[model samples]
Target chain A: MDSIYIHIILLALIIISSIFAVSYARVIRGAIILGIVSMLVSISLFLLSCPLAGIFELSVCSGLITVIFISVISLTLPPDEKQRKVNSVSMMKKMVLLVLLVLVCGFSLYMLDSKNITFVPLMQNVQESIDTRDNIWNLRHVDLIGQALILLTGLFAVVVLFKKDKNKDKK
Target chain B: MSVENILLFKLYIIATPVLFLVGIYAIMTTRNIIATIIGIEIMTKGVTLLLASCGYFNGRPEMAQSFIIIMIVVEVVILTISAGLIFNIVKKHDSLDTRNIRNLKG
Candidate 1:
């Protein structure tokens, strides 16, 4: 009730992993970092009391998406580019970047404090809190159907695009 | 609101813009198509966090949860399809560099 250290820690981890995911040159390494980011984000969401979303994010993004990205990376990446070792120079650059991020965050928080900014939560007068499952099934069933349709369409498109041509004998 | 909740909210609010910028920077600077996709995923993460925090603040966890679920599903599907398309392009062009795929007049 007072403070949640785990939330902060997970959020910090997510931030670091996200930065690395975008900055890393190697697709495999970036994908792995993105997975880490997703896992940390899911944990943070769970800590924030959104367990269902967290679970979906954990299982889907961290698990499913990471696998897809890694598979694609392996398939498309050049074999010769597979084995680049991270030397001291790149490590130094990362260290410097990390320090810069910390400084920027500190400065921004300081500025926020000086500005006397306050966050106002919206929708403060909702009379009742509904069950998430009920909300999904009853109120949002239409959106649920849309999501299913989208998932099916995407799956179909990918399968069609990747299917091996049986008509190669024509050549 | 409790101190932890407020702190969490602030952290996410600050994080959203920072991560968004990082994602944009990655997209702009990276030459590799896969890296660009990674950047897009990072951007989506930023937006998702922002949405979740808004839901938390509004005390509408269910609404937020549903949106997040929908977002995650859509993001994964988009990423998969884009990755497949990128793979196809790479097979045709023999290069993952975006600049190499420029001449599409045929």
Candidate 2:
């Protein structure tokens, strides 16, 4: 119960920071910050008592996504140079969209408030005392093997499909 | 207003979507391909956050957390591969800008 307020504050921080990421002049920096925001969200989940999702968000998401972002594109652009290229119309469009998004999010929160779904105790009335034995949060052997297979296959597919760029001269 | 009872709903229902919106805005507005990928990552995290919140509120943490784990794994593989591909492209062309990419579109 005392925790809800903390979560609320965290939530506010998440939104504000994301807005900063959106508006930042440095796109790569923004992406890096956005990854931090995701980590915050993961933390917020754990605070709310959702450990599984929290771990996922924290371990796999926070760093992995940044690697993806950093990997996919070089982050050497100057902010002002990029800023000069961004037209006012595009910025205005993003602002307008953000406003609408906020409204919808607010409305959904209101709807959740209309219902009384709080105070949920852990494993309230399940026949499955199995909840204790359930290490759903922990990754296991078969899981790792399955994942390894998937990644290996995906790599193979990429190799088979790598086509050389046919046109190196549109600049 | 008991602080504990505050529902913390705004973070999920509000903040989550806002994060997603901002992420989208970043993706759409940025010409830097890496930044755009970051935007996509932000939005994906926003979604996972919302799911975890829902699972928390409903006392079904496993459902949300497991999904998040799976999502994260998939995203990492895809992201790594794509990053390598994008890097390879840039190295061959000397820039990561979209216009340069379009020129290589043949």
Specify the highest-lDDT model's number.
1
Pairs that clash in candidate 1: none
Query: Per-residue lDDT tens digits of candidate 2, residues B69-88?
Result: 66677677777666665666
Candidate 1 C-alpha lDDT tens digits along B1-106: 6665667677777777777767776776666788888889988888888888788776787888888988998998899889888988888877677666667776
Q: List the residue pairs that clash in candidate 2.
A: A1-B4, A52-B65, A53-B65
| Model 2 agreement with the true structure over A1-171: per-residue lDDT tens digits | 445567777877887877777676656667677777877877786786666667667766777676656544453433355444642236577667767766876786678677754544455443332231253424334665677787896687577446455585543
Q: Relative to the true structure, how large is the alpha-carbon lDDT of every model? A: 0.78, 0.65
**Candidate 1 overall Cα lDDT vs. reference?**
0.78
Per-residue accuracy of model 1 over A4-77 as CA lDDT, tens digit each: 67666766777778878877666799999999898888877886678999999999999999999888887875
Q: What is the lDDT of residue A92 in candidate 2?
A: 72
- TM-score per prediction, in order, is 0.81, 0.70
* DockQ of model 2 vs. true complex: 0.42
- How many backbone collisions does model 2 have? 3
Identify the runs in model 1 with alpha carbons over 4 angstroms from their true place.
Answer: A2-4, A79-127, A166-168, B2-4, B103-106
